[model samples]
Target: MSAAFEIFLQGTPGLEEALAEEARATGFAKAEAVPGGATLQGQWTTVWRANLKLRGAGAVLARIGGFPASHLSQLDKRSRAFPWGDVLRPGVPVKVEMSTSAKSKIYHAGAAQERIERALSESFGATIDPEATVVLKTRIQRDYVQFSVDTSGESLHKRGHKPAVGKAPMRETLAALFLRQAGFTGEEPVLDPMCGSGTFLIEAGEMAAGLWPGRDRRFAFEDLATFKPDLYARIRSEAPQPRPLEELPGLFGSDRNAGAIEMAGRNAEAAGLGGAVTLAHRAVSDLERPAGPPGLVIVNPPYGARIGDRKQLFSLYGRLGAVLKERFGGWRAAIVTSDGGLARATGLPILPPGPPVAHGGLTVKLYQTAALR
Candidate 1:
């Protein structure tokens, strides 16, 4: 084993446990949930699996090395002593992010950063850039420091497929995690009544088809000198491709904004899922169940934070409830919103609700209502 690894998952406040639960189910043994992250033990294969499978994880990191540092000089010396050649190449540009805790005497972050940067550059000629192809973060909490490299270059949520988006759009990773929470499999018809940019719908299609989330992109670690490219290639070659579109369930989505729907269609097509994703210009009020007896209906409507009014959202929720109860009674529904009061206004008798998940600095709840009468 190289070392005990840490996998960092980022999302709205309430979704940590949900994301942790999913990570555990996906062979990440001994998974422990923390605020904004989950640390688990696994090898490089686990790291690779995480980037490919995790829907809620915003970033996956591999712990390169670290040691305790009482002062700035100790921090610099310990950092320089790390085997940079083991993980980083000489030519690749890198970025450094540092955070200090109360126990550390290194009050000046810039000074601390400069020391580490100088150490790396002088020792290995490693370049640092914020927009670089690779990023390494040094976090000093209390007197201990942890050095980690971001294996997932962009946030895993990017998925590199969505070129266009709408206001207040839901992230692909969050949508995947929510779908799992709502018991969504790719085998059932899914309707996103207020689908913005079709993230949920596209993710649903990918999930049902067993499509690897990282299939369309390259990882930052691939460029590292010590990275086992052969091992990674073997892992990728052996991964099970999505069963077949015919065997998976169809996906459906709609939005009041025709532009969002158009963008969603284009994004889905770009992801090679145009045939699997069905998007249309439709309002939540007009949502209805097709011939399917019961499927999953997920809506991420505006929570009065941005385009919609807060008081007005109550009416919208009420109308949405009416539509769900009358038109899609048997289907399972999941609604994501920042407003708890507006969620209750839907009058759907949802359960106690899960913990708050963080989304763009806001605490959003994944509200679910099932067993509709």
Candidate 2:
């Protein structure tokens, strides 16, 4: 077995606890939530599994190795002496990124990055490309240097299966964490009346079918020297077969725009959920309770900062609240919005909102309610 190392799961800022919950539920060892993300101790296989299974992490980073460097010359000397060949293959293109703090003597991030890049190129014979697939992240804080590898190439939210997205579409990583926050266990139905591109519905349906989020995607870890094809293949095969769509709970979505509905259907089919998700081109005012036991009604509506006028959205929110209160008895609701006033306009018995989450340059919160009377 490979030696264990520190693995950091970068999470959505305000929803770190939710990500921590998911990490623990997924059986990661020593999973602890921190300010920006979660941490765990694991081996190379664990790193691969994290990239494959963790739905809430924006990126998975492996803390390879580092040493304290009080100055630029020391940083360059130690960096050249470090065994870069153990994890990084020679001749492969790579990128170096650095962050520094005032507590560190090496407070110049750009200069530090240059030293590390030169060391890799001259001493290790590695190609440094701005657009490289592999990224080496360095942090210099309190006079200590720490090195980590960005094992995930692109953001995990891409999911590789969703190529078409509507305006201001919710990220899959954030969507998954929000679902966990809403207490969704994949055992009940989920409806999204404002389902642009069907992100919420598709994520819910995928969970119900026991699908893995990274099953369709590739990661930068595969390009590392530590990657083993056979071991990774076995891990992939260990995933449970997807449950038949009929055996899973119903997943429904609706949008007032016909174009949005078409895009949603295409994305669902691409995700192997063609028959499992039901979508419609209908307004939120026309939404009706499905013929089944009560479940969750979750939506990510347009906010005034990004989409529409604040005053106009109040009536829209009011009508939505009225429809749910009058017809969807015993069901719960969760709304993701930037304006507390907009969420308040719904007039559902909302609990205190979750921590503010940064989304698309705006801070948003998740407002939820207990099952309606």
The candidate scoring highest on TM-score is 2
The global Cα lDDT (0 to 1) of model 2 is 0.93
Model 1 ranges off by over 4 Å: 1-12
Provide the global lDDT of candidate 1 against the true structure. 0.80
* Residue-wise C-alpha lDDT for candidate 1, range 123-214, written one tens digit per residue: 77888777887888888887888888888888888887778888887788888888988888666788888887889988888888777788
lDDT of each: 0.80, 0.93
Model 2: weakest 10-residue lDDT segment is 22-31
Q: Please give each candidate's TM-score.
A: 0.94, 0.99
Show where candidate 2 strays beyond 4 Å. none
Please provide, for model 2 over 1-373, each residue's C-alpha lDDT reduced to its tens digit, 9 standing for 90 to 100: 3799999999989988999899999879579999899999999999999988988999999999999999999999999998999999877899998899999999999999999999999899999998999999999989888999999999999899997888888899999999999999999999999998999999999888989999999999999999899999999999998999999898999999999999999999999998989988899889988989999999999889989898989999999999999999999999999999999898899999999999999999999999998
